[model samples]
Target: MRITLERSNLLKSLNHVHRVVERRNTIPILSNVLLRAEGASLAMKATDLDLEITEATPAMVEQAGATTVPAHLLYEIVRKLPDGAEVLLATTPDGATMTVASGRSKFSLQCLSEADFPDLTAGNFTHSFKLKASALKMLIDRTQFAISTEETRYYLNGIFLHTIESAGALKLRAVATDGHRLARADVEAPSGSEGMPGIIIPRKTVGELQKLVDNPELIVTVEVSDAKIRLTIGEIVMTSKLIDGTFPDYQRVIPQANDKEMRVDCQSFAQAVDRVSTISSERGRAVKLALNEGHLTLTVNNPDSGSATEEVAVGYDNDPMEIGFNAKYLLDITAQLSGDDAIFLLADAGSPTLVRDTAGDDALYVLMPMRV
Candidate 1:
């Protein structure tokens, strides 16, 4: 294919597609990015069997052709070229090699048959909706930290996305957990989003999609089916197979009877937990929380090492209660709070606790207590 494009534009498109290409591939074509030059546009596609990304950029196509080249190598070559340089890509008659040139630099990259590239079949999606990029990113960022890395319970390895009717309004909800803690976030359901099927989007796909949502002005179109899910943003599209396992009933784990509430400054509480965790290096990062009337004390003790205790004034008027929790878990939950104040609801030392932002009730987090 003979195509001319600005160096920066090509590099930007490559960066988006390259995320799906694996570093080491058992199949030769899997290491290459498929380039197709057609009517004033160039399409770059890459996949790793599980996820696929396709990006199109405006280019001057002199000859209509297609070929595959090393994804990383091509990306590096274009990246190192001088800014504002024009890139020329052409393929020989036999299509055995691809020639790339920019100013004084030129190189020939080995090519693979475009026919060998895996094709992702479009699934029959009955439901589709549009979401603001910022809203979707917030849903993923707030709950992704709780996704399980353990492969044994495969259902817990992704974010569970579904629709729920709460307070007489439909809401889009995302939930994730790894047994120790659970995170849940909700937003107003978009137009035409009714009756959408619940799907478990795998962790890796969620991470890759998150990078593409940086542009707040862009709106993403999402299509979901029983077997596959597709997300389209601007000129880029991503398709992936959905996890087959059923996610556990997360609602059961959320505490409904926790009445003892404590409100603390989010940043201060996180910093205190981080400081105390340093003392207990061998005890799995445990920190004790002792709460009293209008005062909260954080303490960490390691028999072999020293102990640390810090007290912060809070907005709690409940009876004195002492609870032990892993400092890391506490920080993870607090990091998701969107406001300066974090509200914690505790039933007792032995019951699970619920946390929420003081500014709104759109998001809620629950953490199971740990013995110190």
Candidate 2:
């Protein structure tokens, strides 16, 4: 079997699918990518049992056939080929080796029977919907940083996606938490999303989906079942297994009675925190926020090293109070704010604090305090 395709087209498709192949695999077939050439198109697929990605690119198919080869090895070979060059993939009579010829370079890679490759069979989808790429990107970017990495609480390792009626309108919401901080973002629910069961998209899938949604004009089709989800973007199709666990109710941790309010320039506050935290040790880098009427003092004390203090004027007029927070957590939440001013609603030095963006009400964050 033989097929010829443009190097650019082959490279793009491989770039999208090869990422799903794990670097190290216990199974031999799992390390290879399945390639099928048929009807003027070449389809490529790679999987790690839990997640699978498939993409098809246009090709001149002289003979239709299928085989498997090392995913990363082939990708590297195609990537090094000259731009705009054509690539020819041909298999021998015994299908023992595949030849990749492009320009003056040729490579012979050991081949495996396509039948040996596994397929992640998606039985049926209970809900399917379409969403704008920009909207999807917003929800992911706002909350991805808060996803928990603790293996024990597997439920918190992914973003919880569901629909809810808020302000008399149905909205699609994404929430993630690590017990210390929580991020929640919302977008207007698209049609066909109503009554969809909430699903926890695994962390790996969210990362890959984020990379594909860079084009704001693209429309992404989403199909979800109880245990698996499939996303179609342009010619690329991605299927991933959903994390099977119950996500803790994150709303209870969000403070509702945080009366003390503080408003400060986002950039200035972030820079001050960064400068002060430089003096903090690597472990338990806590920054103390001492708030007074219209003034805030940021301090970091490291007994082994030194101390740091900076003052910034704020819009606070409440009773003065001191609160402690992780320097890294403060910076993470601030980076997600797309506004000039960051609003912090505080209850006390121990309870959780709520953060909001002045630019929009679509996203919010709650951060737990650290002992300083």
lDDT of each: 0.92, 0.96
For residue 261, give model 1's deviation from the true position in Å. 0.6
Q: What is the TM-score of each candidate against the true structure?
A: 0.98, 0.99
Mark the regions of model 1 whose C-alpha exceeds 4 Å error after superposition.
none
The residue pairs in collision within model 2 are: none
Best lDDT goes to which candidate? 2
**On a 0 to 100 scale, what is the lDDT of residue 301 in model 2?**
95
Model 2 lDDT tens row, 1-372:
799999999999999899989999999999999999999999999999999999999999999999999999999999999999999999999999999999889999999999999999998999999999999999999999999999999999999999999889999999999999999999999998999989999999999999989999999999998899999999989999999999888879989999999999999999999999999999988999999999999999999999999999999999999999999999999999999999999999889999999999999999999989
- Cα lDDT of model 1 overall? 0.92
Error of 2 at 33 (Å): 0.9
What would the per-residue lDDT of candidate 1 be over residues 1-372, giving only the tens digit for each residue?
799999999999999999889999989899999999999999999998889999999999999999999999999899899999999999989999999998999999999999888988876888899999999998999999999999999999999999999989999999999999999999999987799888999998999988999998899999989888899999999999888999999999898999899999999999988888889876478889999999999999888888999999999998999999988889898988879999999998888999999878988999989887
